[model samples]
Target: MSKLEILALSGSHRHGSFNTALLDNAKRLAPKGVEIKIYEGLDKLPFYSEELDGDSIHPEAKRLREAIASADGILLAVPEYNFSMTALLKNALDWSSRPAGRHVFVGKPTAIIGASSSILGSIRAQLHTREVLHALQADVVSRPEVLVTQAATKFEDGALKDETARLFLVQVLDNLVAKINTSELIKTASQEKAS
Candidate 1:
């Protein structure tokens, strides 16, 4: 009955990025009892380096890890760049999955949605992002995929305006919450079995 918190990461840092706008819409469309917190400072993270990760982790990386650990779920607003995910997003993932076994992403529920001005709607980026999350052992939502193609036409005043896109965004948020609840239940069951 407590509120579910989802950490949202925007893969783009451009002013008025479509992916960032998608995240804003996601925040607005999230269901009741769910809170979508959009994370900033992705651009401030230093490039991942083992030397930098040792002993004293970068403050930004530590902040990213802490946010991931505290959230019940993650939502990624990915953007396509040359048929791949942006380096900024890849960098965040690298920082989040660190120290070989102390990463924050293992078994965490996540959902991915993207918007692009192109007709493909960042599908390639989303696919790559999903693959990375899987590698990190994150539980990713696979249904009601939200790919807002030709996204330039889908927004007004920096908010999602397309009715169909809005509807699908709602479904994505709902599915994310469901995945989180299911994950919690599974963890409880495993604990009970062990005890």
Candidate 2:
């Protein structure tokens, strides 16, 4: 019943990144009572290292972990490079999935969307991201995938202009909220049963 806070991560840090634009549009189209915020520190994160991942973790990594831990769900605007997810994204994931028992991504509701110039529209990146999320035990929304292929033709001035893509993005957000709600319901039921 409370507002939902959804954190979005874009894989690209380019000046005019299509993935960033896609996330912007997603923020605009997010349903009422839900807030979608973009995480902007991926480029600042150093490559994951166990030595630095102890109590002395980088401030940015700590920020990223806190954001993921507090959000009701996660939205990813994945970008593909070399037929896989960008290092920025993978690095963020690696940084967040640390300390073994206290990872924030476990059981978190997640949804994936992407945009690319390639015809496949970052499909490989999203697939690879899903695999990584699975390994972290995150719950992912699996329906109505949003893959904006040939992205240059689908947006105008950094906003998603394609009606079909907009529809799919909205559906993805809705499904993410539904997943979060379902998780809350199950948790409440389990607590009641235990009581």
Candidate 3:
């Protein structure tokens, strides 16, 4: 079997973001057959505008779209912002959703996990993100979510060193991988039946 191509998108833009650290830790603990890549250019995407979208879309926007288009699955690490998703992530999604008929996020498999300093651990943000992904026509993994609260205490020096958090992240990754593999198998079977 080939390695699963997984795109890890961090919703926080801060250099020392806890959510980013969690994603970084996930990269280290990813299963053997999963190839994880962290996307760090969400801040570069401009606000979505139909007039600016054409054959000549912004280079950054184009790059982000292409990354999503090429990925087999996506893992989003979101941080709560006033009980909602961040503008940076929302902006990236907006750009990717443009050209209506040619959306990059359509039919993609996605999973969301979040970490925050508050006790709620960005749970609301994760819920909102799941809804947004659904609207984008994504096959979102709905189980085994990771919501790390008091994130500063769980991770140290830009790494998630806590035993419990690490275990939860592993479970989340496993669930995501299972979902991806199952979807792939179903797709292949459908193609065979069609043939």
Candidate 4:
């Protein structure tokens, strides 16, 4: 089989976002046989409307779907906004989840991490995001949650400077890959049984 590829999305679109930096760190720390691709253009995706979702759907939505479809798993570095995930990320997910069970996020393994300047980190946002993913039927990895709270102290020069946080993020990525592997194995076994 080919290498497992993970598509990473940062919930924040702010300049020099800590969540985006977390994804950058994940890319650098990913284990061998795994690849992390960070998705850009979240800002380009228009608001999702089922009325426009059929043939005239926005091109950016299609890009998001294609990107998710090509990945073996997804890695989300979400930031909190009013104790919930950013609307930008939610919009992208809404676009990707269209057409019901046929969307790319279904059955795909996903892992979530977050950061914030507050001591609480982005835990609330992550929880909400997890629930949404679960509703979409994504196989979310539940262990080794990484929440980089007080981000001002943990990151510097647009990178994750804290060793502990870096290690935790790496653990999350590793677990994501493992979950994807398990999913693939199950799929193969089910196919064999059907044959």
Candidate 5:
């Protein structure tokens, strides 16, 4: 089988963000057969505006869509802000889910992990992220979520320092790859039936 590629997107734009560090750790801990690419272009996307929702969209939005389309799965590293996902992440998702029903995330298998200084460790933000993905009709990997609490101590300089956090990230990657494979199988079976 060809290697699976998973796009990694972090909601946090802060330099040396904990969530970004979690994604970096996940890339390091992922099994050899999978490839994870962290996307850093969320800052370039404009606010979702209906006026700009024309047939010709922003170049950054197009880039995000193409990246999602090429990947076998998606990994979202979210930061909690006011008990929900950061606006940066939400805006990225909004841009990708545009034009109504023809978005790149439709039916895509996605995994979410987060980090925060709070004891809950961005769990609330993860919940809200899941809701948004579900609304987009994306297949989300619900288990093996990595929630790194006390981010100040768990990560340093955009890297995860905790061994347990690394382990959870590996688990999340494994589950995401499995979900991608299962989705491919279903798609193949459906194609066969249709033919």
Candidate 6:
């Protein structure tokens, strides 16, 4: 079987964002045969507007769309902003969902995780993100939810040094991979049926 392509996205724009660090750690813990790439240009995307999405869309937006289109699944690491997903991350999703018929987020397999200095650990933001993904027709993994609270203490030098957090992240990845594989199988069968 071919390796699964997983695109990782960090919603935080802070230079030392713990959420982004969490995603880095996730890459380190990914299992064999699972290819992971981080999407690092969310800050460059403009707010979504149909009028501006004509023949000349922003290059950054185009790049993000292409990345999502080619990926088998998405792993989002979000940071809570006033108990919600950061505006930057939400805007990126909005941009990716435009040109309605050609939406890049539709039917994509996704998993959400978050880290925060707060005790709640961005759990609310992750939940909100899952709802948004569902609205976009993405299949979001519901189990093994990851919310690393007190992130400053949990991670070090962009790595998840905590044993428990690492284990939880592994389970989250396993669930995401399973969901992606199942979706691919379903798509293949449907195509076969059409044939």
Predicted candidate 5 versus true structure: per-residue lDDT over 25-144, tens digit per residue = 888888888888999879998898877666778888888989999999999999999999999999999988976798899999999999998999999999999999988999999888
What order do you get sorting by lDDT, best first? 2, 1, 4, 5, 6, 3
lDDT preference between candidates 2 and 4, better one: 2
Please write out the lDDT profile of model 4 over residues 7-61, one tens digit for every residue: 9999988898999988888999998999999999999987888876888878888
Residue 34, candidate 6: C-alpha displacement in angstroms:
0.6
For model 5, the superposed segments whose C-alpha errors exceed 4 Å read: none
RMSD of 5: 1.2
Candidate 5: deviation at residue 159, Å?
A: 3.3
User: Estimated TM-score per prediction?
Assistant: 0.97, 0.97, 0.94, 0.97, 0.96, 0.96
Error of 5 at 34 (Å): 0.9
Query: What global local distance difference test value does model 6 have?
Result: 0.89
Judged by lDDT, which candidate is best? 2
What TM-score does candidate 3 reach? 0.94
Per-candidate alpha-carbon RMSD to the true structure: 1.0, 1.0, 1.3, 1.0, 1.2, 1.2
True-vs-predicted CA distance for residue 78, candidate 6, Å: 0.7
Better of 3 and 4 by lDDT: 4
- Per-residue lDDT over 1-195 for candidate 2, one digit per residue giving the tens place of the 0 to 100 score: 678999999999999999999999999999999999998879998898998788898999999999999999999999989999999999999998987756999899999999888999999989999999999999999988899999999989988999999999999999999999999899899999999
Is 2 or 3 the stronger prediction by lDDT? 2
Task: Give candidate 2's error at residue 50 in angstroms.
Answer: 0.3
Q: Candidate 2 vs candidate 3: which has greater TM-score?
A: 2
Q: Mind sharing the TM-score for model 2?
A: 0.97
Off by over 4 Å in 1: none
Model 2 misplaced regions, further than 4 Å: none
Predictions in order: lDDT: 0.92, 0.93, 0.87, 0.91, 0.89, 0.89
Candidate 4's TM-score reads 0.97
Which pairs of residues have clashing backbones in candidate 6?
none
**Per-prediction count of colliding residue pairs?**
0, 0, 0, 0, 0, 0
